[model samples]
Target: MSIWGKFAGAVVGAYFGGPLGAVAGTVAGHYAFDRELDKEVAFTIALIALSAKMAKADGIVSPVEVDAFYRICRVPEGEQRNVARVYKLAQEDIAGFEAYARQVAEIFADRPKVCEDVLDALFYIAYADGTLNHAEEVFLRRVAENFALSEADFSRIHARHNPNVFDPFAVLGIDPNASFDAARSAWLKASRENHPDQLQARGVPVEILHLANDRMAIINSAWEMIRKEQFNKDV
Candidate 1:
């Protein structure tokens, strides 16, 4: 069965007894303990919950942004209602985003890369409306902090999604004055890290591997721009 199918029958509330559990309970109507709840399910729930919180951060939830969440999550037609319920429940939950972030952080404590993927997913939703507002940036930063992500980590992810600015160096998380060899190494490492296969192996749901695809595109673009710039300077 697909992840959504499993989610429908899984006792998510019992599996994660917190605001997230409340979301699952309210949506699934199941409160029985589910020891089989896997990291993929937790990742999906965290993404949806965080995405919902992100939509409300700027005080104006754009339809475009909501559409982006649906697209990023790849919510199926049959499961849209259930997924929507989760989103709505998350938004209405009294606990702040910090609570959700902390839960996610703990769940993926050993898999820090997955936490970065979560931040990337949020960035995708945040910029879907064409811009990242100040409020949204602050919210994302707080989420990153809660996830135990470093400032460099946040900047690299932010640079990848921030359409207003294109800093190749920032995107690659390398210094502007780095040698071509160093830049190439950075690009290679980033590409490997953001590769879909790597993400899947690290527990990101297959449904959302497009997050890696999109990020790889951004990383490659930055690499190409830097390569060309270096060639020009060498000439």
Candidate 2:
């Protein structure tokens, strides 16, 4: 079963049993899930390390970010012990950092929506100590773009701490549409124009590609939200 499935199973088992059973079930389920996929364990560790790297970008890593990461992992004491082992393994694999990001991109690629969750959590960590520096913003923006967030989405999230503003609709060169089809057409056109892959093919740098990816993610998310809003109104 997938890691996500195992987590779901544990949550389900916990509810059916006493609190103690739930705790035990959650641990056992995670252990089984980890054992079934060696690569998954490694990838999880790598992701944590990546998070760590991002956290330290500003030359300081806050206690809150550390705690948030542990909270996200959701492991019991025994499982956490194992996770510590994996964490150490990840720290030693610095050469694999880029590869780790690539792996993560693949794992979560099909679910671009989840990238927002990840980014939100990361920002929670970044701002936990009540401040964010330029280095922190640089790394966070890079990761956000890698997930293909669009300009609107990026600006929305970016504005959280950065404060300086930009017009999202204008960034995509679109105006309020009288029809859904027009809105979608404009959004799709912007997406194709800003696609990271397309820019990369034209010899854009990795940093630029990352920027494009971030913009695309935001555009796609905004379009989806608009579509859903229109559909709900019609319903």
Tell me how candidate 1 scores on lDDT.
0.86
Top-scoring candidate (TM-score) = 1
User: Candidate 1 — which residues are off by over 4 angstroms?
Assistant: 11-14, 232-235
lDDT score, candidate 2: 0.51
Q: In candidate 1, how many Å is residue 5 off?
A: 1.5
Cα lDDT tens digits, model 1, 30-97, are 77665446788888888989999999998877899999988888878988888888888899889999
Q: Give the clashing residue pairs of candidate 1, or none.
A: none
Model 1 Cα shift for residue 111 (angstroms): 0.6
Cα-based lDDT at residue 70, candidate 2? 71
How does each model score on lDDT?
A: 0.86, 0.51
TM-score per model over all chains: 0.94, 0.48
